[model samples]
Target: MRRLAFAILGLFLAAQGQAQSIVPAPPQVAAEAFILVDAATGFVIASEKPDAALPPASLTKLMTSYVLANEIAEGRLSRDEQVVVSENSWSQNPVFNGSSLMWIEPGKDVTIGELERGIVIASGNDATVAVAEHIAGSEEAFAELMNQHAERLGLSNSHFMNSHGLPDPNHYTTARDLAKLSAAIIREFPEHYARYKELDYTYNDIKQYNRNKLLREDPSVDGLKTGYTSEAGYGLVASAKRGDMRLISVVLGTSSPTARKNETRSLLNYGFRFYETARLLDAGEELEKPRVWKGQVDYAPVGVLDEIVLTLPRGKRQQVEQRVALVDDIEAPLAVGDSVGTLTLLLDGELLYQGPVVALEAVAPGGFFARLWDIILMWLASLFGG
Candidate 1:
């Protein structure tokens, strides 16, 4: 009996030691739906019912910002362009509407830049409506444009009923879709994303500060948007970059402001703690030397079009591997950016992302005489054994 008691005690101690060495607990979040994604690779780090559709509230402004960025990029609108505030924007706001506002009187002129500041820093519903009207000529038309852009971005779980994320039952988006949208904005528009980090903006002398508490909590937290309503609850789409790793986290339908902040912070912490980013291929890294039939060079260098970076869990770096393949015998004429081959990333034997390798420079077929000689050689070889 004494020996058995001692053995049991030893077994219990070993069990405890093993438990302590296991993976740490995941961070806790209070939101009803949430997702954390690595911005570089689109790899989902953590998600909780990320696909469930819920009210987006003012988070709809992310789509608004995306549209504005594209317009600015295309030269259709300028930051200095003036927009007139209509009765639609001012009449709905009183001291009681709980809406953020610049308190513009009807016919007051506001610049596109100020409108962007109002939407981003103040979460102004009126600002959203005004910007939408200015951009598309009507809020309804702007909503259509928003949905079209969402479709182009492959936001499958999203639908837009209004420019402002009001509590319309039809206006809904999934946490996963929101994260994708946020990532697209950050990846596609670096210059425009800078607006999200501004702590305060003065419109008509009313200084409105950004409500995203995470930006104040962590300097690395730069963007993107926040939302709240009785029906939609509190939601936030937040992003931060620490070193080479950038992450986008979305929390939807939280009970309170504190819960939204806490959940977003926890999700970001969890993502940063357990994951690290690795660059598998540097930009312009040559992958192959495909034979060129003609032109100035005998071989054309095949290289990656862009750097391939991935975010992986800690201690799993050794598991990341890549395979490069090139097209069979190249036939001369090739232009820069022409797809030549592919570099596939694999983790634990599962394909992650396949990056296409492109031709570095143009290669034209050789002189007519050289081409004729090659054709004759090929024909003769096919015609006779000798």
Candidate 2:
């Protein structure tokens, strides 16, 4: 009876391990571009042709949100600031053209908050124009600001021609850049992002629903925007959080809204279903001590630059291990935060996260006598060419 119980326990453990290895199924969509990313760690969970540059359509609003949120955070702009609609914004540029309202007459008043809601909830090209004109004095100037912010955000595959994300030869972004931009908005502007999740917002006595259908489909999805144009096709940038794990999925150039939502949902679901976040090392946890030469202390304690965390699947922890590599005998006079080495977490021989190991405490060369002796020895060795 004891032997049989032990055998059953072993089988149960083995079955649990097998279950943990199961990964979420791949998304089914006809999108020309797609990307899935773990929002917390900025890890790329999956991607298919993520770098292909395409017209972003209304997805360009993500950049607008980034700029607006930054301005608000810095107190440069207030949400209640009233903006007067300009004729140029109403006129619309012929070169970069898309749907808009002839009814948004010039000389109308709208608050900054309304302008944001107009664009996000209504996908109003006119609202984008109004906000751009109010903020940067003109859409041309605003486009320059958008490109600058893109550069600052390290969006290598993005360029902005207009604020409204109308089809312009120059207005382009890739799936990866869009995902990065979306993640930045959520991380840097949590307060501003709250508006994106609003299912319906009323402006000028007109009720408008958010174009992002996933918000209605999945309660977990809270913030994001959707975009489309004749040339750009249907696109959606959606973000969702389940527990501490959040993911951003971008699907661009899909055939239709239903397809975009389905693909985005699949990508996000795969991320949540398969990946499990594990905290390996807490902040200030000493990972190792490396030998030091000619220092007051014989060795220096090295620790994670920040808390070490990873998003992985269950049962994979058994295959995970950290390898520490430190500089061979760090010289004296090392300062805190100095890079000493690196701690690499590996799973199945694949590198997951490589973090810098830094000096936790400063180590100066010993007494004056010790320093002088070291200098003399170095000089003698140089003179003798030894």
Candidate 3:
């Protein structure tokens, strides 16, 4: 295979003799585990022990909401469809004495959508159970579905034991895993995700405010969740967008509500202050057209499967480079999405984007004489070390 290197045009480029600014060291954050990731590229701008599995408190409700989101997405449930609250999920259940509850009464008046708001904005354990029972027959069965989603989303260290996330020895997740889940919720289910930003929600004439204080403190911050349990400590997952960049910050096992909020804000500030994100290439913007041997067409179109985005240190975006290593004698029939080459975007040691360069169009096998001639040509090229 032969490789081609070129500068990415039209992106921000540093001018000659411009004022030099080195990215400052990441700020120290007070938390057991924390991470800041660029939402579009899922790049870890900074992290500390982000994979340590620990109790997630109500953060586990994020997964419960995720499962509910999936049910809605797949047409199994609708937001407005009513779910009858069971006696077990009543607000006054003794099992939920000190935890959050949405004041749900055992009745048919509640909807899946209402419970989504209760679960997210109110952090209501009763609401979580209602939705869980309505979807999976019981919380235990619902947890199995949550694990299925955890497996699908590549939440390697996260497991769900219940829908409410009260506390259990086996119920734990990593900071990194929660960040991934938060990003997915924002990206995949905006309708449901919008529930997280509501400062206050009312059910049964009781008003409850969202526990995620960042939603009120930072205008850029929109929707996410907060958690607190004696065993889990205070935790928060926040997502904020500034200009072209959106970031997800996770701070877990902090000392207090104020500590979680401050630590999260600190992480977000550090990431935004030090890094920048931009799209390097649009999907289907042809990057290469390489020769296709033994095919009806002599060439195959090659490009990215999706748009290429990158998060880089401040001022270093200008120095980034693009490289495509093309297949030298790509034999086909080639499928539309078959890998044609490997594309890399590099700035210093970090290649914020590294993904398959795929065939934009398919190539069917050539007729007998065309194949034979191409084979002979390939042989001659090999003989001369071409």
State which candidate has the highest lDDT: 3
Candidate 3 Cα RMSD after full superposition onto the native fold (Å): 2.8
Q: Which clashing pairs does model 3 show? A: none
- For candidate 2, give the lDDT: 0.80
- Evaluate model 3: give its TM-score: 0.88
lDDT score of residue 339 within candidate 3: 86
**What TM-score does each of the candidates earn?**
0.80, 0.84, 0.88
Ranking, TM-score, top scorer first: 3, 2, 1
The digit string of per-residue lDDT tens for model 1 on 1-386 reads 00010111012232343323223666777788989999988988888899999989889989988898899989999999998887777736552287666556677888888887788788777888888889898989999999999999999989998877877778899999999999888988888899999898887778878889888989989988888888888999999999889999999889988888889988888888888887766788776676665455777887786887777676565556556676654566788888866767666568777767689888877888888776676567557842
lDDT of 2 at 74: 90
> For each candidate, C-alpha RMSD in Å?
10.5, 7.6, 2.8
Which candidate wins on TM-score? 3
lDDT of each: 0.80, 0.80, 0.88
Ranking of predictions according to lDDT: 3, 1, 2
> For residues 1-386, could you state the per-residue lDDT of candidate 3 as single tens digits?
47564547456455677765588777899999999999988999889999999999999999999999989999999989998989999999999999999999985599888899999999999999999999999989999999999999999999889998888999999999999999999999998888888999998999998888888889999979999899999999999999888999999999999999998898898888888897778888788788889999987788887887777777776677787887677888988889877888777547556788889988999999999999999999999987
